[model samples]
Target: LSTVIDGDRRMFAVTDFAGADGSAGLACDTSAAETIRAEHERTVRSHADTLDQLNTAVAIFDTDEKLRFFNQAFQKLWGLDSGFLLSAPSNTLLLDRLRSEGRIAEQPEWRRWKENLLSAYRAVESQEHWWHLPDGKTIRVVANPQPKGGVTWVFENLTEKMDLESRYQTAVRVQGETLDNLAEGVVVFGPDGRLRLSNPAFVALWGLTAEALKPNVHVSAIRDLCDQHAANSPWGGFVAAVTGFDDERRDRRGQIELINGNVLSYAVIHLPNGQVMITFVDVTDTVNVERALKDRNEALEKSDQLKNEFVQHVSYELRSPLTNIIGFTELLSLPATGPLTPKQREYVEYVGSSSSVLLTIVNDILDLATVDAGIMQLDISEMNIDRTIAAAAELVADRLDEHRIKLAIDATEAPASFHGDETRIRQILYNLLSNAANYAPEASTIRLTCRRLADAVEFSVHDDGPGMPPDVLESVFRRFEPRANGGRRRGAGLGLSIVKSFVELHGGTVRIETGQDRGTTVICTFPDKPSGIPDTPAGIRDAAE
Candidate 1:
């Protein structure tokens, strides 16, 4: 008898068991079909994930150039909607756009794609080309040969990359040109102690060029000299001598004696980097100037010593004779030397006057010598501007009356507070007022004005006399210069120079304005006192030069 087995769990079955009995029979193959369906779904999901992550567009095309599978990247790259089906027409759409633009550079080496499309498969390696997208973006395209008899293209946007490269090249070229054109020798070495680069000046200095500069020569060659002079240290020890590293900018300078008897000044700079850049400036001219200056200074020192001896000898010689002359003149003026005749009295008076003038000249010369020797010191103090001006004006009041000049004071409404040496300020004002009185024409109006400015007070002496010419304006403050006072009188010209020096010492300025038709004005401006300084007229400062 033959038996039937269930196929779902059957390990063995009897031969000729094809009977479809109701109790025992084979089941359908539903489990196998479900397994195969599950595998197909998993494969599709993996492919979709891979296509989504990629940056470049991917497409699988058929032999006829009809796109079979297009990823999302392809849609974004080509500005196409997902619903559009890719075909030969879509491929031709891109090609047609490229043809209309004709952007590819024209050259004899350039190949036409349409004419040799079929032969592309024979190419050994992938080919690259450039594309200018409609949106004004540049792309570098690479065509990869596919085993399936078609090509896969990938593009990398090269706009930013190309621009950066071009800029880098331009910057390097400019740096090279600037260094090469310089007269000073320049050498840049890498941290590894090799001659990385040098300028034309460096080559000229060393009698070498790019082809001649070998790798072995470096700062180490001068190690002995560097040790002797800290400044000459290859590592720039001299920078510490001149400036503190805590400061922002540091400069290191030293001199180098070359083998050929030439001396050079080397300036070594330490960059923020570990590398050091050294510049050699041929300071031959500077060295020569320094030697000359030294010689001149020695000569000046000797001359000053001689001047001191001469001053001492002259002072001794003049003092004894001056005392005798003054005593005799006074005795004669007193009518005690046996009642002198009228002519003798007049002669005695003239002698006295001449002697007094000579004394004044000697005093002026001594004062100038003291100033030149720096023996005169400034006595700073608070000064009332109006009081000083009044005192100075009083000294010249008699002269003003004698000349019949009109004198006007414009200080009643202005502030009179300032910080300066009282005596110096008075001297300055006295000199300026006296100069005006002497230079102005008879009966000319002299206006003395004082006013407060933003940070200083201005004192002015204005005259209605002839103004200065342009040529005289430039050197008016020079010592011993005479003014063209209507071609009438000449002055010693030292007054203005003294005024200028005194005013500048007190952190002030003096100015002169002169012209032919318009009269001359001498203005002196002084720094004002801070808010709470008291106003008081003090004693005058000692007069120097």
Candidate 2:
């Protein structure tokens, strides 16, 4: 007996044992047959479970074009429910789905498959097929022959892969657009010195088109710029060295002048991917400002030389005539040289006095002119600080007496020897002492102190006079800035300003301190002498020579 089942139906075959036996009795072994039937049922159940767990859809079609079996995946792919059996002749939708999904091209592969299916061939294979699922997805498919008179097919969807590739292509296009639109001139060079890529600005700067920029462009072609400008040659060297280093990344910065007189500064960065990007910026304004400043400095120096020449010439020219005039006036003033009436004697005395005043004015004018011209050269020498202060004190002694000012000099612990311009040093002290005596009130005390500090010597003049206002104290050294109601009570403002300039020229500084009731104090510091120099009493005179 034989039994068969197709999905939902069953078939059975029974044998009559008595017909096959000749004079043999038949016995029914119900228990043994029942055990055999039970084993068979268990085997079939296990197979059905295995097929249900499969990921891919499996289907079978008989030679008669009737669908016999279909797996879970196959039914889901076709959007079909159970109880639906498909036949090759009745199901035009299957063919339509294959054609629309581009699985069966109207070419050799599809044509051959179609011929086999229409002829009801027992078994056939489909070459690289595809199908369109109900959900509008494309699935690559292939139908293979089975041992039984049927065909088994398998397919997988490829929608996500195609989408990813399409997006990738779009991203590349956008990146290219961004590079081209950049403002900086960018030129990329490949590893072999070929032009791999360049932005629009770069092309315009080099006076070349995209077609002209190629890897074959020689390094020598760009090296000529080095020989053209010596100062700018280092920039070219930087470019060549960085490019030839074969490094992952390198940078070079340089300057170049364009045909239109514009200066261009560029920075080039080399990337590991055989590319170099160069950016350029205009620097014409900076270059022009520096050049103009250099030219102006030269012009000022020349102008200063001319002014000094004029002052020296004038001083020499006037000195000779003044000497003679003063000598004649002195002779007339001498009583023994000539006897004269009272009126004549008075006139001669007047002429002598006027001549003396004129001589002093001329000398003062010459001294100031020389100082302004920077020709008042200092003669560095050694001198006694105490003696220098005494001489300065004597020079201003009469003024001090006239004002009834108490003049005190404190040089008890000053340096015994120093190297500097003695005459200029004395001049500075005399000016300070004289200014203090003249500007302070009649009963005020003027103090002059000199002391040796760590690295230098300090000289200060302190006066207990009506002090300068806060505003005037700060600018006391500025030329011609009058103090105490426009300096009506003192000498012209040039004296202190001149003192400051000459002191600074000797590498020293001056400062003033004052308040409403507190008197003004002026301090000047001079650098100390080194131990190598010898001390001499005649040091001051020798320095003057």
Candidate 3:
């Protein structure tokens, strides 16, 4: 509506007029501008939210090097002031602030480092750098060049992840070292019948080139090399085991006499996931020792039996009182016995443990004496290998748990049944496990491996503990030579000695492989049928030599 005034405030008829583009034109343009502004705001807010959600710090700069945007994490990561950040400083200015705040380490040449880092501005792809800060932080920086004249910088903290990877690598190194120090030659074959891993012992024993031992080398090539060392080599059998030629696919073992007059006892282990492992050890000394002692020792032991019986009878008489002492100690340990002081209880515990150890040594001594007297005979039967191992592991479970140790049993390749004296076998397994548990580090695993061969049963106890030195390894199987070496406790060192005596009595073999940084492994091999080798007590003099 419009009003027209005549000469002097005179009223005319009201009328409405509009141009070609009226209020609608201005309103439409304003509405379109408002919608575009709102969309842009939403996009920026979404991008900002994403940046804020990330654990890494991120920032973007324009082509002119002026800071356009940075997330909250960016400010927090650099410990920068919000007021200074809001001023839209340049990249150089921000770096200057970081340097002044002692956030980054001092560069040998600041100008060159800054220039080299900034060269990513002209690069087409992403560039990365590691920043070691003075505050002990390690930042992995990635500079991604944007299509339109700018860079998006991402700063990630890899401190914890790197630390974990370092520890894992250390464990792996220890494992590799352990393998290298083994007395037995171990070679693992993948499903493809190619060598996957071999230890230094394998290389040295077979005269193989350590530098040339690599993955994916075919078994035939290895067989060809090994055949050169033997008169009638079992290389063909080894090839068959690797290729799964025998339909039965069971593990096998046998003795191979080398052309140089050396005898190596070998076992082929069928591993899970279509893998195979073969181990070899030179058993010439053990065979020679058995042969040398066989007839002479039998006659000597018969003569010594009466004297041994007298010693054992006294030992048996002493066992009863020792048992009573242990039982009474247990009774006194109970709270109902008395309200003892903490120190007193502790002293009692020490006494109890010491007495128990002494009693165990006495019992071991008595048992050996009985064997020496030819009064005990091994009752061989079909033994459940898995059950026996579980039983032994259970016996040591409390001690293992006390030390925060882990146990991993690998009997996947073991036979279901083995022929041996069940009690004695359990005792052997128990002693091995107890020794391993004592030495294994906190949170480390003790692995028990039982492998069955065509004619024998093999047991191996492995521990990821601070290993024995060469001298310790030499003396470990000697009676009364135990040094705790940071284990749970010190013993009379009769554990390995007993293991040796029992193993030899079964007409089998026992060998130890150990080193300082590597770890230790004790392996025992028993034939399927008892050799019926007569037993005689190996004297302390034998251990000394």
TM-score to true structure, per model: 0.64, 0.53, 0.45
Q: Enumerate residue pairs that collide in model 2.
A: 57-74, 194-215, 195-214, 195-215, 381-420
Model 2 poorest ten-residue lDDT run: 536-545
| Segments of candidate 1 deviating more than 4 angstroms | 1-41, 63-65, 76-84, 87-116, 119-151, 155-167, 212-276, 280-316, 338-346, 374-437, 443-464, 467-478, 482-484, 487-545
Residue 545 lDDT (model 2)? 8
Best by TM-score: 1
Superposition TM-score, candidate 1 onto the true structure:
0.64
After superposition, which runs of candidate 3 have C-alpha atoms over 4 Å from their true positions?
Answer: 1-40, 81-87, 115-125, 160-178, 207-214, 227-255, 267-275, 297-545
Please give the CA lDDT of all the candidate structures: 0.66, 0.64, 0.83
**Span of ten consecutive residues with least summed lDDT in model 3:** 23-32
> Model 3: per-residue lDDT, tens digit, 25-76?
2111244455587899999999999999988899998898778889988889
Clashes of each: 2, 5, 0
Q: Once model 3 is optimally superposed onto the true structure by TM-score, how far is the C-alpha of residue 257 displaced, in angstroms?
A: 3.7
The digit string of per-residue lDDT tens for model 1 on 429-542 reads 887787788777888889999888888888899887778888888777765567765634565555776777666656677888889968889999878753332221111111
How displaced is residue 291 in candidate 1, in Å?
Answer: 6.1
